[model samples]
Target: MKNSIAIRREDLNKKGEKRVAVIPELAKTIIEAGHNLRVQSQKHPETNENKRAFSDSAYADLGATITEDIAGARVVIGLKEVKTEYIAPNTTYLCFSHTHKAQIKNREMLRTFKDRKTTLIDYELMVNADKARVITAFTYFAGYAGMIDTLWTAGQRYALAGQLHPFAAIPQSIETEDLNIIKKLIQDIGTHISENGTPDDLPPFINVILGQGKTSTGAQEIYDILPVENITLAQIPEIYANGDRKKVYKCVLGITEMFRLKAAASLPAHTYAALTIPQKESHYFQHPSDFESNLQAILPYASILMNCILWAPQFPRLLSRTFTKAQWEQHQTLIAIGDITCDPEGSIEFSQETWIDDPVFIYNPATNTSTLSMEGQGIAVMAVTNLPCEFSADASTEFSANLSPYLPGIIAANYEASLENSQLPEAIQKAVILWNGEFTPRYAYMQDYL
Candidate 1:
């Protein structure tokens, strides 16, 4: 059969997930190859002020069929997970199915795919020959939006406490679609800090960033816009005790520095060296139980915590209720937490995934509950799950550019052929989680989860 690919609209249930897997420019490539292309009519914000990466009309103009009939196509594509009810039997579906981690919530969705005999390909598992990720995600933007939002939330928290500072002058991430506006705001905040210095009313401000991965790099980009000093972890105490309050500080932590063996007071030099060494078989600490959280030592001095680490069920909580409550009672300087990973009850135990419209909530350690407003006693959390949507245009363009290389292989695959005989690229073949409803060999481990 001739290849026919369909691009489905993002699930409406997920707010701010406005990204499209196949932009119009890429759609033209698929159409020019003499293959059938179908795109769902995407819905956008009603106001013309909101900037969209591309219009639905743009897809139609490229000689592609634009409609809501996603089920009619042989291969379906999307940015996020599709609803199980929309999964057509015997059809190949490609998207980010988060079930790789055996998430309980997605167990039923995986079972439904098996029952419907649908072929599932997960984008997250697409890796190169070296097992490194081929599709670089919008993680940088997640950090960018997260850091910007964290500073804005901290400003609001200070206002509620009747403390005025330079952060108050900053704007929300969504206030303007143009990234330059946000960059200028960050620059302005830096200028103000450099000139007037931090207010005496506020405690010494230190931003602790966890993980030095792509997410942290993105967060640092926004943070560097401010006139701040980068200090080593060993220097934190000295600066906190005698450093200038007028200036801000930043510290980045790696895996070894963030956690130590549960039984040992500190990680030994050999173990630390083994983990720190690069290109050495990628060996590190085996299990989460082997380590204990080492974040408590720095909690007293932090004004903002940007968590960029990837956490799973096996990992220990970065900050527990007891620790947070004690710090809150002491009236610690920590005011805002940017849980950029947005894992619900994951790394940051008090964290819950928040929407773009309602991005922040105050987590009351005393009550162990959350309130929408940043007022009252508690630390404010900026946990927007879909941070990239704030810069959807640029994110989509980057995402599509990375995905373009695999398009021909994806569209030309013969779904009828046996899994091993299929003409898909090795990367795509490796990403197949389900073949005709049964778990693929690479993903058979998910069978227990099902």
Candidate 2:
């Protein structure tokens, strides 16, 4: 079992990524099961600071080696993307490669696998028999961090507006120790809002969520900590003008509610309009080009917008530049947004991935520009790419729990054999993007991206 499995250190260049693929407690089990483990030393040779949430000594104490060279191990696992040069020949690597759609950024990395004879198993594609995600802790935790950071952005934005508020006291996500502490702080804020209402100059705090998926739900879970009143989209303007200022109002909008048919290119004008809501939804799903951004009706009255949709270029833009400016003129209350999805210039036209070091930006839609300062008439966007890293220990604990059950078996599996005849589980086998330097049948389409 010598060098059976190794957990690589996260890339040092990636700031604020302290989470590890495996924790020390889990490493102890793998060792007790008679599999050798090597955890990359978090002790950077140049710096005294341990970069990882878990210390190297924690793994070493549990019969795991704290080694600098984990690439030589038969199985190397990580949380994020690994460099192409780090992949040892004939070795198997498990991580989120993010090249399933043949992304332009990772084309070279995918090409490197073909010559190195290394197996690339993407965690994102690891789905159970029922097609449910096997690794979901990260997505779920991301929502928690995104909304928390969004609140931080609101505090900062409000302070810039010369409005002194209690929320302005809340720190950034990474500044806090864990989710429990953050939740307690938010609960305190909720109590404060109950005792003293939000600023009268501003409208009611209407939080409009864009999707209903796991990420969206995670955001909702965090938002629920506040004294909130769930309301429908139809009750917005009236609610904003007359609703209790102390209570935060929430409205969740699905894709169909945010986007609509453009010009009826798919069917007759009247027939398309006459279609039932579900039928229209199906049609819009099949042909996204027929849809146009319809968020103007929802965006104007919102104090904060949490975008959690999994979107691409083919989909209609939800918060376009023109729409952002128009909405600002109407209400000026949509000041802060938590783009939890973090798609760069994707659905939310102005949002780009911001790092934890600089997690938010003021997007001036009027000038099509952004500034790091949260000042000016523009809206504030908190779009941290690796949000879960804010609560690294908690995130790592959940990730380790989900991935630990599969580790002992995967470490003991026979990778020398063909992938079809390998000892890997069916779900894991299906997730293999590359096997021994060749594109697996399921991932052969990736060649187009390279």
Candidate 3:
């Protein structure tokens, strides 16, 4: 109903922080790893609770060319996926958090990788599920409270993976082993639904809700009735405890409709409500009509919240996004966009950094080549961008002013490239071809079918 923040100058710059702060953190990790971390951002040595966890630069030494723009930092990383501009031909990139998109994008920047010329190593493949589970959960919850879309989007992605099945609800009467299998399947189903769902497509997959049966009534009662005993036997409880029953039935109807018409809605309305927040926080609380789009960015990582909050208690951020009153009220909405999430106490922000300079595997068609760049020597790091929510743009311009000092140049560079038709430099282009050939092609292939 309001002007999209994307069109707002101040809001756009504020949203641009995603790119502005990555470099210094990457540099910090590199520095800690005993490597040099340089960035263009005006740098000052600062640390936080998470950063404090790292050993006192015991294992590695890192230095960076600090810069105000994250784009510059990303440029130094020599990662092609983030930008398509320059190639530090000789600079070896070491990064973690490798994704298919990043893989292809990097290859685009370093064209030499596919020519049996360069190297790209994906260290993320080595990460165990446990580690991913920890970080994933925290981000997922933040995605929910903040109305981030990527979290819910994960279900749609899984559907694209060909992991969807008919609605098979977990039965209360089933054996523990059977229930476990159902749980796994449910998780898989959820993943597919999120990853593949679109406004035009089917809801992605069917949900099988196991109605409360007499045999396993206890568990069912716990899930279905909640704080109430089986006071009476009725078609449904007084209220849908967590809206589970209603969602399940709706899923059944949606799935049936999909089969009949060969089409499905992007998502069921019931589930969508749980997945996103309704209250839109004004960005920076400055403009009254700076609303552009709802924050649908957290969908891909939705399950992360369940994992972090229920499964792994080690991580703290699964609770919420840390935002100051100013930030909360500033933007047209309350939540952030992508993997970046706020902390539990709403005091800090954190995000997973996997592929800044990951070992990139690429294939070159120009010279009929395969290449590896940034192999093995990758770094894994997390960033605590702006102070949780304490520093607000309206309260004081200090944050805006100081942000440039800590912002990563890579962020700026990517923003610039995004505006420039998403083109990368020559070398990076080759690298991207190879990267796409290996990783992105898998998804791209499926997309072709879709």
Candidate 4:
């Protein structure tokens, strides 16, 4: 379970609110520190009935305020920002969100903090190192188990494609520490399920936390605000059992529907921009918020598949060599690749000739960019683990499905030729494929030509 310092939300006037649930232990620590916790509340001009209900209150006595305006109260104690209207200029801002690019982009606010002498600290930096170790153990276990429940079942038993558990990516693009923290949380979940009978015994936030390891609990918890349809057991791993046509179709349909939604929502804004085929002069149709919202929706489904292999029974034994900290670090370095422009009309070439080997790419202390180049490579390897079925990370079949769409023509083509058809010449084929596969074609090419 995450600590209260990681949860607790409060409004000044609302005293009886249930509050955003957090790790109880973390909450106690803040109380013991005697820091006055505060949150922002929007005064609804339309309704005076609840106006000023929680206008002012200390962090310690939050019960009444919480109950009155549950939605109005902001969870400030753990957040990076408590709106300027709510807190004193001197109030400190402590939260993981502070590290995210969106928040950091607010240079004006940061300037205000500096001018006001308000201490803006990332508490995660202080507590996460130790917390991550414990968290990792649990998340690794939960992720490992959840993958099994979601992806594989042979009768009552489950099987794994490869002998090893796959590596799970920490999606927090900025906070490497939080990413580490999330990885730990996943390990913890895996441990709990392996030891316990039900994943229910654990806090729901724990699962949300694992799924949204990179996001703030406040933002991540908002998904619970959305309606989630109950997924029937028959729609899950049952296809591996009875193999009923109706059941299988329903299952596949349900999955395909979900994937469509996920893809739409998860597709990057840049991807959308690429799809838009903008004219020389253009007006943007979507807001950044829209992109952010949709991205959040798609990520959970992706995670469902990404974590599949982690839970397989055979995964722990077969892929042990790859999931280690050293390997994870190596893998982590590879996940971050460069961004490329795509042609909306599919006429332009977006291809890479080669992946230049650069050791300095991992951690260029001199330049201060540690994870940028590594991202692409990491994404390439992560493609295998990101799938929803039994597949080896080392297998070309899995790699092609998970990553090719995201890859440029050169890199993706290189991956296909090198891994899928080993009989093909590596040096000549890789080079030739990049040259020919430069631009995305207007029409999809059939792999089999009769």
> Which whole-number lDDT from 0 to 100 does residue 13 have in model 3?
14
Query: What local lDDT score does residue 353 receive in model 1, on the 0 to 100 scale?
Result: 78
Clash number for each model = 1, 0, 140, 62
As a whole number from 0 to 100, the lDDT of residue 92 in candidate 2 is: 87
Task: Please give, for residues 1-450, the per-residue lDDT of candidate 1 as tens digits.
Answer: 468899887776677677777788998989988899888777633432322357878989999887767676889988777777878888889888888998777888788888888899988788999997777658888888889999989888888778897898777787775677889877877878888888876666899999998889999999988877999888887877777866789999887667655665254646655653441112234555656677877887888999999988877778878767876777567899999998888888889878888888888888888998767677899999889888887778878888899988898888888888888888889999998788888888888986
**Which 10 successive residues of model 2 have the least lDDT summed?**
42-51
lDDT of each: 0.81, 0.84, 0.24, 0.25
Which digits, one per residue and each the tens of the lDDT, describe model 2 over residues 1-450?
334888888776667888987888888888988887888788666565566899877888889988887756888888788787676788888888878875677778787876788888999998899998888898989899988888889988889879876679788889985799989999999999988988888778889998888898888898899999999888988998898978788999887788877774667668887888889889878888888888878776888899998887777898888877777777566879999988877888888878999888888777889987667768899988899989999999999898876776677788888887777887798899998888899989887877
* Model 3, total clashes: 140
Candidate 3 lowest-lDDT run of ten = 1-10
Winning candidate number (TM-score): 2
Q: Estimate, for each residue in 226-307, the C-alpha lDDT of model 4 and write its tens digit.
A: 2222233233333223332111111111111221122344445355545433420122123211211111222212212122
* TM-score of each prediction: 0.92, 0.95, 0.26, 0.25
Query: Please, what are the lDDT tens digits per residue for candidate 3 over residues 355-375?
Result: 212212222222323234221
TM-score of 2: 0.95
